[model samples]
Target: MTAARAAGAHADAVPDLVPDAAPSAAPDAVREPAPVTPEAVAAARHDLYTDGITACRGAFGAEWADRLREDIEAAFDEARRRPGGAVGRGPHRYYVEIHPEQMRGFAELADHPWVRGVCEAVLGPEYAIVELGFDIPFAGAVNQPWHRDFPSPELTRTERRLTSLAFNVTAVDTEEDMGPFEIAPGTQWEHGDGFEHGMFPPRGEFPRYESLAVRKYPCRGDISARSALTLHRGTTNHSATARPVLVLGVDAPGAGNDAHHDMAVTRAYRDALPERVRAHLHCPVVDELAPIVQKHTIEGLVMGDA
Candidate 1:
């Protein structure tokens, strides 16, 4: 049975399967209707707070998208050549965490007005980048079970405010067969027993039906910002080409814990970044190589144990 059906069954089996908060309206029925504009950014801020996720289509121009796409291809080639690089998650899926400074044309993305605006809206003006990596799901990759990025029972139990936001930018147009990112809207605020444990719950334990999981299709240049606590998963990729999306994390000042990823850039590169972009980086610059790669697995990808 599908995860949603199984979750429903589990609810019936357990008398007090903590009922999920009533789901919000289906995302498709009332999808955000504006392009990435000043007004759209404002609306997106509201959506991020209320729905826990939002997208800005064509936030960057086509030229910028093309440049990013080329960078991704180059990064992939470079990773494949380095030791411990181009790690496999499953069949065709792979991932690598590299320094943004090493990728040409990527530095601009961190300072892109629209991208920075959305991130700042949710993570606050003092927000800083906590993690950076590439998520590439190729053909034959299977769907991941629904879960949050960093689940902290303690934070969920006491904190009602959003502390961190995830930023995703597609290197290429995300077609349906590419298995674009999917999310269960509005689950950011829900907390349950054992929710803060380091591990994800079984598939059957997810409230897939209640959250109304929806796949997001963002074309080249589109960017998405979401609360890290929001329930989400990477779906199956049936297309011939690999889908590579840039993953970035921004945290409110003093909002993260010890588990967050720490990355560094060259001193020269760090000095060149705009004050806005530099403020989000908590790590200091080093002269050595950046972009550390390690073996990848579903467990590592989900629980970050890797």
Candidate 2:
């Protein structure tokens, strides 16, 4: 796997790509419910702290993934119907942030033992769910500039403490021509000088990132988490299929990312959620679900490379 290979070259390589034991024989195999052990949490924490990423293969069954995909397609259709509903992320690529109620598996995803364990392990026990969204790159989507999701926090740049993390769940099995997500392990710690908006590195820095980059091919039911500060990009998609992946953002207290997102749920939905799940959500409980006006400030991605 890329994690193992990258770890060999970079001492800070991720060791927790397979958080549990080896992945099941089938990509869609339903995992029996089990408790997340201290050892698993410790390994996941180490991977996040060192390589800035970790993953668990086949975390959910294929049926669940299919349902999530159906929900995403419905949401995408709705978002595309309205102006400013889907934010452009370069040609043929769009990003949409949605309310928790928009997804049928919101609670199941948020309350999953592995997801909970990783958040608590890395961001401490008080981590908050701040964002729920998806990125869809269709055919003709151009390559994105190598960049971090956002600028590093002051604590991360100075005190070396990571305060936030992004978890991704792909809606379909990934193919190379579909524009696999690529990331440079350990570059999250690189506090470089020539970054546009403190997120995108200059073209001159591309070669360095390219040399270290590893393309990820996550299948349905797979989940990966990474520091949003890591240098990464979406390669050009040459296939006809659109690659849609769910993004869940979590933050440690004082991370301040919740300010940039408007993740909300209806009062009825909130009332139905378990207390543990409610504890992680920092967004508001409103009577209605409003379409989120995309507020992500990565303007460089609006026009991808030619």
TM-score, model 1 to reference? 0.78
lDDT per residue, candidate 1, 221-260, as tens digits? 6788888777777878776656778877777777753244
Error of 2 at 222 (Å): 0.7
Error of 2 at 126 (Å): 0.8
**Which regions of candidate 2 fall more than 4 Å away from where they truly are?**
1-35
* Reference-based lDDT, residue 112, model 1: 77
Which run of 10 residues does model 2 get worst, by summed lDDT?
14-23
Candidate 1 residue 236 Cα shift, in angstroms, is 1.4
RMSD of 2: 10.1
Clashing pairs for predicted structure model 2, backbone only: none
TM-score of 2: 0.88
For each candidate, what is the lDDT?
Answer: 0.65, 0.81
Estimate the TM-score of every prediction: 0.78, 0.88
